[model samples]
Target: MSKRSSISRLPDEVRQHIEQRIAEGQMTLDELIHDLRERFPEHADDLPSRSAVHRYGQKLDRRLAAIRASTEAAKIIREHAGDREDARSEALTAMIQSELFESIMELQEASDEEMPAEKRVGLLSKAAKNIATLTRSSVTLKKYQEEAAAKARAELLAEQEERLEELRGEDGMSEQLEDRIRNVLLGKA
Candidate 1:
């Protein structure tokens, strides 16, 4: 087994406080050692070495980076999901408007006594064609949005899976337990 770190000898609370400060970029090793010496003179000899503290800081930075990437992936998934819903709603509205326009064209043709029969028919046909084109465009937009959302979700899952694999390789833990830990760390659990 590997030797235990000297920093591990410190109380959990103290260790966490030191790590938190390091992670927040609030203190460098020299600064931390000086502050510790000043604040807790009694434990001056027990303070961690500069290299140990630096290693801990680097580890914390990696964890923070992983967490941020996971959060950004989730945000992308949510945005794409919202876009898909918006596309579907727009398509539905377009279809409804097309039907309404067609109905209005028929009513206008029947009610306008001054308009010639051939001219009225031509105008009605043109309006109907325009509405059909809009409806088709909406349908196409909805399909594209659906595809984008699916792609986003798939990419996010793949990225999380890769990160989990890397964590597993580094940790050498049981797959099931590592998965649980990964979920908890990523806030999925």
Candidate 2:
């Protein structure tokens, strides 16, 4: 296994401090490292160099940016989508499928000589199986959404029919008119 980074070996409080400082975007790598050493003298040796700090900072920055982006996306989805769990789930699954597709394409482009044939084949096989499973999941979600919607529509129609029963012959409404309304609502007219 690869050795862990010196920064990774830092104490929890120090690591949290570094992560917070990095996230705040106000500290340079040199400034952050200097401050870390000064603040945590006993564990200064565990602190990373500027380059290592830079690498870790970049990784953390990307993660924080992704989180902010996702937060913004969720806010937008909530504002417009309005409790649309199925739409969100479908969109998330699509995004995952797209990422998997790109990764598989990259793997396909890599030569077998770069990796052992069996290992590469195994990876591809796993990818194919995942794609199949994801597709099946998408199909199942669609069917579930459809079934739930149909059930809801049936319930609403039943309630409407009950109201129609109550309204029969009231306000000069006839059975013929109610039948017409029911047929129109049912798309059988």
Candidate 3:
């Protein structure tokens, strides 16, 4: 049977705490190690090596960066929502293309020279296609959401009209009763 790595064996809560600390950038690696040792004295010997912690921190940072990028993209798309359709599409396409270019540059820099040329080309092609698809999807998604919202608004209005009609019918009957009462009181019934 395979044994779990020290980092993997740590409780989820502990790992989460470490990741949070790493994300905050409030402490150095040595300080982080010391703090963990102090906090989990019982498992001090079971803690991951400094290098493992550093790797984990790097991975966490990458994930966080990706999330931030996605959020920024979403914000950009939403900000263009009130624009004309063509304007919105152009804005989205520009934004996505710029991001894709930056991502390709970063990937090229990070990729090892040992990586196959074919694989690299394939990756770039896929990324370009993905950016194009994302640009198209963003516009389509906004249209669908707007349609759904309008439909919901229409349904709500219909329901309200039905309710108002029922209230108006009751109001009319009440008025008729009041008129009859007035006639009887005047000895005209």
Candidate 4:
């Protein structure tokens, strides 16, 4: 394929430069927006059109660049900072762990706090206890409820089957009746 056949392609050097800017956090959404405005100076004349296309496109480009940069940075960090004890790495690790610990403690404290009076009373009252007792009464009660419902469904199904059987029997019964009626009204042949 001819090199010119490739559509809207950036040179490798330009692509690398952009990727580097992203990794260094220099190519942010805000920076992209500012750069776009500076480059496309006429875009601000019509607010609506600019807002729809120019602004949104700039924002999207910035977000994509930031994501690329972050991925590249993570790769670089993993490769260069492997098992190293740099001050920055230690600080980041300590900060993350402390934050996690604090969050866990806060959650535990929330769970241990006395519940609201209304909720506590609802769960622990004599009436609530009685209801709980009734609900928990023999496993057979629960089983029986399910069984009774199933039995009712089976009874309805059996009734339908019986009705279908009666209808089928009537087909023969009808033929017998017709023969008897013909014999009575117009004598036997």
lDDT of each: 0.72, 0.81, 0.73, 0.49
Best by TM-score: 2
Estimate the TM-score for candidate 4: 0.21
Q: For candidate 1, what is the TM-score? A: 0.40
Best by lDDT: 2
Write candidate 2's Cα lDDT for 4-32 as tens digits.
57778888898899899998889888799
Candidate 4 residues 93-134, lDDT tens each? 444455445644443344323445465455446444554544
Ranking by TM-score: 2, 3, 1, 4
How well does model 4 score by local distance difference test?
A: 0.49
Q: Taking the tens digit of each residue's C-alpha lDDT, what string does model 1 give over 1-189?
A: 133576778878667778768877977789987776787677778888888888877877887896687567556656776544454456456556866676665547564455667776787687778778777877777787788779877888788878777777854879788779778756799
lDDT of 3 by residue, 5-80 (tens): 5677798877877987998999999999999999888877778888989988887898899778866766776786
Q: Which runs in model 1 stand beyond 4 Å of their true positions?
A: 82-189
The residue pairs found clashing in candidate 2 are none
Where's the lowest-lDDT run of ten residues in candidate 3? 82-91
Question: What are the clashing pairs of model 1?
Answer: none
Ranking by lDDT: 2, 3, 1, 4
lDDT of 1: 0.72
In terms of lDDT, model 3 sits at: 0.73
CA deviation > 4 Å runs, candidate 2: 1-21, 32-85, 111-116, 169-172
Work out how many backbone clashes candidate 3 has. 0
